[model samples]
Target: MNTQQRTSTLQHSGVNEAEVSKLFRNTYSLLAMTLTFSALVAFGSMTFNLPHPGIIIMLVGFYGLLFLTTKLRNSPWGLVSTFAFTGFLGYTLGPILNMYLSLPNGGSLVTMALGMTALVFFSLSAYAILTRKDFSFLSGFIMAGFVVLLCAVVASFFIEISGLQMAISAGFVLFSSAVILYQTSSIIHGGEDNYIMATITLFVSIYNLFLSLLHLLGIFGGDD
Candidate 1:
């Protein structure tokens, strides 16, 4: 290529890189903000002894926001949706916090949450950086697993069963952990091209994993 053509090509590539960096930065920054806001809401809810109705509202509202976020993943609205969803998640977490706080070993729950979060992030980050393998292949399996898990969750409401709950929780934890690996791989090499979606996926995976781990811990280490 001629000198001028080379210069033009370089400029275009530079622009692309800059845009990618901006997208990545914006996604993570927003993710952090959302997490913080949600934590605040959860703490507030627990502090005030919020009613079950309010907690339910937070749950429904958060999921509604999640639906919006998914639908608007490619638009500016997606960002707003993410913010709302995270805040809702934080609020929904209040009840769990309240329950755990009431326990003598409540601090263990918080510690478990922090530990799980750290493990997920560190493992996924490592996988993303060290491996060249594409995890998109797991997409279909993850979806199917999620659907099954959702069905089980819904079914649990109608049927009281400990074994089933344990089974489902175990399955969900494994599935979400896989999702973390997949999402990380996608961000690193799958060429997702959209950091907002990436962060959302990663956040969801981590959240679910944490919940699952907590469930397992409660099952095995209750008040001990």
Candidate 2:
């Protein structure tokens, strides 16, 4: 939104052009840094062939750190918590990536998945920013989809459902993409005022998007 329009809406939304611009800068910068840190941790973990922590540990660590980060978001410690969360997540992924790498044409699949993720995230995010369209309408759908996705994930452990993993991956690809659009649009339109939270949200979407792509590619491209 332009300055004049922001000024007109200031009483209602308290969002100005300068605030939005600052949020965009801070969020993106922190996101880039956190991503780089996660990559480094992933690379190191993979190099050492770290053991998989299993789903339970992974879930606990992820949610624990996420909650901690959210609580400390206004403090300097928030940055530390963000790295801890992202780094732990990347470490957890190393074992999965190694499993994929052990498959036929695994390297190619990983490369392809990463490429696709970057393409999808950047393109959708750019579209949201340039268009500056309000995407708050997607909130309800995204939230509902997230709950269903979580349930499916939990149920897969007990139920021997065929192709359930692939289905979940596909759902995540769509869900994560919508989240990126919604998050970017929210930032541009000044719905999210906190850059720390914005960074975490977008970071999570990117991370999940990449993992989902990796799973889908591995399912379709890996050798039998």
Candidate 3:
């Protein structure tokens, strides 16, 4: 209403905008770095023909590093933990990639999956940023979806159900896309103030998206 009040409000709004912008920049910068590092590690693992590390080892290593990252999210140690977690995932991925590469048309399958994952991520992220839509409501859906997906995954291991595995892969593709949008929205809307956490969120979404797409492609496109 009054000039003084209007001016103060404008200044506060500008400050908030600047803070969000900075957070977004920092998050992507860290994400890019981590992705590159992880890729390098994966490449090394593949070149050296590293073992899969087994399911038990993978789970323990992943959860252990993830916990450390969360606990140290506000500190510099968080960056170390984040890289360690991602690198571990990448190392696990190497053996899987090697297996796919052994199949006929495997390279093409891998390429297609990688390309599609990138396309989906960038497109969803752009949509979120351009529209500035609040996707916070998807929070509950994402949580529930992951819980169900996890259960289905565990069941598939014991049941040997092809349909269930396909369903889980499809679900992951959709949910991972949703996560990309939701995380981007959170950064721009000021819901996520920590770049370290934001980077981790986006990176994991990308990882899941890539692997899910790979699984689906391997099923449909790989030669028997």
lDDT of each: 0.75, 0.90, 0.91
Residues 147-167, candidate 2, lDDT per residue (tens digit)?
999999999989978899999
Number of the top-ranking candidate, with TM-score as the measure:
3
Q: Is candidate 1 or candidate 3 better by lDDT?
A: 3
Error of 1 at 62 (Å): 3.8
Task: Enumerate residue pairs that collide in model 3.
Answer: none
* Per-candidate RMSD, Å: 3.3, 3.4, 1.1
Candidate 1's residue-wise lDDT over 106-211, tens digit each?
7787688679777777777677657757888988989999899989988897998858878887998879878877776666553677777777777777677777
Model 3 C-alpha lDDT per residue in residues 32-70, reported as the tens digit of each score: 999999999999999999999998998899889888999
Best by lDDT: 3
- Candidate 3, residue 207: lDDT: 93
Q: In terms of lDDT, which candidate is stronger, 2 or 3?
A: 3
User: Which window of 10 residues has the lowest lDDT sum in candidate 2?
Assistant: 9-18
User: All candidates' TM-scores?
Assistant: 0.82, 0.92, 0.97
